[model samples]
Target chain A: MKITVSEKNGKEINVWFPTWLILNRFGARITWQVLKKHEVHITSRQLRRLVRAMKKCKKTHPGWRLVEVSEHDGGRVVIDI
Target chain B: METIGKRISRLRREAGYTQDTLADVLGITPQAISKWECDITCPDISLLPALAKALGVTTDELLSGKSESEPAVKIVPKDERRDIGDMMLKIVVDSNDGDKVRVNIPMALVQVALEMGMELPQVSNKDCLRGIDLGEIVNLVKAGAVGNLVEVESSDGDVVRIFVE
Candidate 1:
């Protein structure tokens, strides 16, 4: 799998993954790994909770969209849309 | 014409103040704020000044539905910077494996998939061939820049792409 991130400044960052990552349903695992590698510490459990809260937010507030999920200083997950 | 309650609710949300937050600033209960938003009761005239100030609006704007001053830029706290950015995720699964597939799973649903025991790769620094700070992405989008951010495809023809514009 190939992942490319394009910034507003026209700079692009790309990450290529092996075919097995997606074939094995390891999307979430890879996401956590990427975040951890970037020094954004968040546990698997916390990531699940954050995702659940984001889903709930989207369900209740259709006007709000899921933007980005980040870890705060106090282990708080910040979901911005 | 929009009712006063609706106006209050709209302004409050635009200011990024929840009912409880706005209530705390105005020394009122969240229930009171809810009632005002629900149009069950109006705020006391004496409370208009405090309410307006808390919401960063003039009493005239609150009462007459007009702003005499320029629109204020929303000031997001530095610690809360993570909460900014626009992202769209598009997924397409096309396989003959006789299993159910889905497309257009929002970011939230992707999390749901993970929670449901979908095994993903264990990414390490070596696996991450490239990386971008999410905050930079948010800033670029805020500055009115727009473009595709990321795209991924699986061996089985599943495609996932995330973009901001």
Candidate 2:
């Protein structure tokens, strides 16, 4: 995963991390529980499927821009997965 | 529930789906489908949306044998949440005086510090981090909470954000 944070002052920070940080069993299971809090149902098996799908996408789609957002105060954030 | 099973079975056949086809669409085993049709088990509430769509029915009909406008996918089983060690917590503070503070510490260290009642110099000494309970943050993270865990704004216009990625 890659993250970029831009402050209102125009300072930009970039951070890149391995996908395994979130795709690992512990991270995936925790994510399943978190989504449950939002009433989004997902089984452990289903979450595993999601992880697998993400891994496949990672291989097939390099440098995929997953999200981008800019705040009213001029701060911007972007994510690539 | 038996009627629901019959409804699913009937609708599945009506939609030209063998058990295997429907199972494939929803990413489940055919035996689970058979069990559902036999009332031996119920589909996870989370699966209802995809299941209903596969069978050309609304979730309402799937659950109660009555048709409604559309399907709603909601509710899933609650289960255990566990995490691994050596994860890092990132904290970013934008001070009003234009100073930016970025700190990263391993979650394993936070857990140990909390257990030992030891204060961490990395964050404890920062003014923006004062008065916030690191222990509670750890507990929330342990409970499967992630993303931006904390955001604080001081009267002087400093902003602090903590993220667990």
Least accurate 10 contiguous residues by lDDT in model 2 chain B:
B69-78
The fraction of reference interface contacts (C-alpha pairs within 8 A across chains A and B) present in each candidate is: 0.00, 0.00
Number of clashes found in candidate 1: 7
The docking category that best describes candidate 1 is incorrect
Which candidate's lDDT is highest? Answer: 2
Error of 1 at B152 (Å): 62
**What lDDT is reached at residue A15 by model 2?**
97
Off by over 4 Å in 1: A1-81, B70-165
- What lDDT is reached at residue A79 by model 2? 78
Instruction: Please give the range of 10 consecutive residues that has the lowest summed lDDT in model 1 chain B.
Output: B120-129
Candidate 1, residues B1-165: lDDT per residue as tens digits? 588999999999999999999998998899999999999999999999999998889999999886776332233445543322123333222233432222233434434444443322222112221353434434554454444454555465544343542
The runs of at least 3 residues in candidate 2 whose Cα sits more than 4 Å from the true structure, single-residue gaps closed, are A1-81, B1-82, B119-124
